[model samples]
Target: MAPFPYLAWVAASTVLVPFASRSETAKLARADVPRSRAREKLGFATGQRDATQPLVWFHAASVGESLSVLALITRIGAALPDTQFLITSGTATSADLIARRMPPRCQHQFAPLDAPGPLRRFLKHWCPDAAIFVESELWPQMLRRTHASGARMALVNARLSTDSVKRWQQMPATARYMLDVFDLILTQNDAMAETIVSLGAPPARVARGINLKSMADPLPVDHAALAEAQTALRNRPVWIASSTHQGEEQSVLKAHQRLLRRWPDLCLILAPRHPARGQEVADLITEAGMSHSRRSAGDAPAGQVFLADTLGELGTWYALSDIVFLGGSLRPIGGHNPFEVAHSGATVLSGTHVTNFAETFSGMEELGAARFVSDAADLAEKVEALFSDTQGREMACAAALEFAQQQTDKLDEIAARLITTLELSA
Candidate 1:
């Protein structure tokens, strides 16, 4: 790894992190309500660890990465009787979700802020035997501190988007130093492996692993809630515009407006990529001159655009939708997990930015089991087309189910490798 830029970038990030921590403290007061107890929100009980224990640490960024870690942790614990894992994430939402799902022996925490002092304090206290980082969480201080504590590190199920690679290239030295810190860089596909090597992850350490993201169990949704939602909107042709970013919603709303003129009873559910933006979405709907109601608000009318401003229920929306237009792509954020929506047996529509989940969506498209919309208008057209063609819709759904059946093996392969690498069976 080269020097100057890498040093500066780390120095700058090290400086900025404290400010970022301040912002987290600020956000907690505004939303989480109990501002003072934010640090205790890490999810682990407050106290020193018992001296006699085997410990490994896993760090993830947010809900998606953390949930994937949970899948791996389950495998680790069933095999290793003595090992206890320390899991950490950055957000309260992630902390709460992990509070619900982490393994019996594992503990979750807010992963103290990524500055030298806090990370050093955390490393000294935890003294993990091995450290694992889930996709895209390349915090320098955490990596450096973990390595210094004599814990070997691995970047598992790694990914590099085309855009990210370009940015990293401009600061080759910093990218390389960060890349080299990992003892191994396991990728989900050859392209990612190639990109990792190009970014200076040791070529020998880079290998293809199953994308843990691809392996997630279709999220569990509440059957009672599904039945209730179905009853609430009886026989309406429902489609979801999921994980919608900013500009995409306007197009989706326009398309929704157009579709209503024809289908008249068409129901649309817009689940924004960020729940905090729910009010903004409601405003956008009102701006479009459409009646709307938020799930957060009361008395949802049958004829309004429903803003599903909640977390984790996205699966339920997909399960209920006749079609799903995955949001990020139609605008520009490169797309989200179309596989999740596809697994729900909903016809899937995506825009071009699926660089993140490249291989997964490609397989779905290869099966002719999902559609790639040119944009929001294309999403509307495809949904309208599928609605008029029940036979075609059923065919796509069946193929999607078949495509999903093939992914079960991939999950097992990843979980097995993670268990072996962590030496959990000992």
Candidate 2:
């Protein structure tokens, strides 16, 4: 195999590691260690080796991708009682979430940096029997070195955006070299399967599967917290704008303003996509003349908006609201997961730009499980209508829940393929 470009990548990454180790994101990822103690922070050493048992390693990009792999891991692990699973992710948030959510016989670790030296230490120690990469987190050196170690590799839930395809087309050999490393390539849809093959993945190796996120159970909720929030907002009409981006918050606040005119005691729950931006979102609520309380500050909703500025608690917010508008769709940030809302048995709503989840949203729209809004004005209208019409809210919630339920058979299909590939008879 012509792996020269990957060799070049390893060499270049060696020089970049120093800078990467010091970045704010990296600091968080590496557990807030100082740059002077870089080696300890970056997960260069894999602490222990267990070579006797078959080990399957799965790498996911971030929190979303990491959570998506849970059902697949659970199914496979149950079938292959002798096998163990290791999940590695780059972000601290993903690691924290995985710690709580990973199934029995599954372990979580911070992924080693893709630089050759750390990659070598990581691969040599883990000595995984198989490697599964999720979504689009294909690091060249990581791929080349792991494949060279004789591990069977597969890329599952693969997606190549239009921009990614264009870039891969410019460098065909490099693309093929990376794609060829995978024994199997499972795309999120038929179109993505076609796109990957066109970008040089062998046609025989590529097949389409449902987006794994569709199978994820509703994000876990703290029942006590849910009960507390329920008690706090007793008999109040509540709506949520979840995972809201910067520009979209204004739209949400504006929609809340409109909704308040009709339902004067209307409670708006605003959760930003990033917890770090909680203060900013709080500031926006202030500027919009809305009274609010911040979740991170141990305050309950004293006014119009309840700022859910905490991480990994979306499940609580989803449970508390019947009318849910998923954020990131209002602007061009594509969208966040709509399945999570549906799985929570809430009526899902979104704005026009939902290309990130286009197929899923289209199917929901067809089922009358979700509503699409054109802008802030449209969002307000939809929210107001859902709140006023009790029968409409109940019907929409039931449809959304049914739509989520119907996708599980697709998850069973994916589990069957994984079982076959892993030689786990079930």
Candidate 3:
């Protein structure tokens, strides 16, 4: 018999499925996402699965989570040539990006809504031999149905916060019921492994693993575009404030202003976290009285500040500078990934609030590959010091590069573990 809490959730979700489907379809349409893709959320699986071959399904919640597993999938595919892959994510953005970077023998799908009908139809079509859920994607119905189908299951790179652990403690039976679906639970660190075991995951099945995001392929770079932007900059000293958030840009702009005092020709590339806010960020730049050019407007990096308000071009910007200030840390938003920056041969300067990547940042700081800044003044001061000290900057960059390179072997170990644990060898 199902636990009372699980049964209650099932009843409520079944009743709400229709309304939820309609609401999601309407929202996706409003966002200009294709109707075909939106219908996927309602359990309309597209494309035919190859039944003769083993299919491994991977589910991730959004962009970062979705991208983090590509390299792993590729490695597994190389080892098991007959294994096909199905990757599902819940956002249009993730779908679009995955489509561009999908590994061979892999198909991308929008994950079905976590209700009976959608999961039923989705499972019937795909019939994946094994399923892996990335990070914190814990859909109860999805797990229950997938497990009942007899597919081996694993939860990779699992992590949870203090609040989530407490919440799960309150519903011990429900937590155990859902988590028991996984044959293995590989956590991001020892702490998370402890947390999951405490939350009722079988201690024998839980183990520590590296953060998958840290091992994802470096962001794709466009060399032609990089060349064009470099020509436009005319050899000016360059720095980037990439992935800045809403309240964080004011500080970045002020820091840029301070930077200009020492190096008048220094170029600042301001890439916001959301490119949809291009015009809004442009307004901020204009109001700040800095000369700026907009990337979406087809403007080159000619102005003192270049508003890099587009998608998937971060690698190009990173290629142009060795100094990078990754945002989201300045105001407690939990810092963005510094691994990508480090992989691009840049030394990282970030704010102190990097809880999301606390382990990664701490390791980098200890190795002298990254630094933490308090605010605009501190950010400016650090940037100036790096700019003046060529040897120091190069040493930091080398350390960061080494840190990134060290993860390659770890990824191989992780891939081997997943293949063996999931019995995915073809």
Q: How many clashes does each candidate structure show, in the order listed? A: 3, 0, 0
* Cα TM-score per model: 0.85, 0.93, 0.98
List residue ranges in candidate 3 displaced over 4 A. none
Candidate 2 off by > 4 Å: 1-3, 22-26, 29-43, 46-49, 424-426
In candidate 1, stretches whose alpha carbon ends up further than 4 angstroms from where it belongs are 1-23, 33-37, 40-53, 78-82, 100-104, 160-181, 299-301
Error of 2 at 59 (Å): 0.6
Ranking by TM-score: 3, 2, 1
Task: Compute the lDDT for candidate 2.
Answer: 0.83
In candidate 1, where is summed lDDT lowest over 10 consecutive residues?
Answer: 39-48
The collision pairs in model 2 are: none
- The TM-score that candidate 2 achieves is 0.93
- Quantify all predictions' global Cα lDDT against the true fold: 0.76, 0.83, 0.91
What is the descending lDDT order? 3, 2, 1
For this target, which candidate reaches the highest lDDT against the unseen true structure?
3
- Give the per-residue lDDT digits (tens) of candidate 3, residues 50-145: 889999999999898999999889888888999999999988788888987889999988899998899999999999999999999998999999
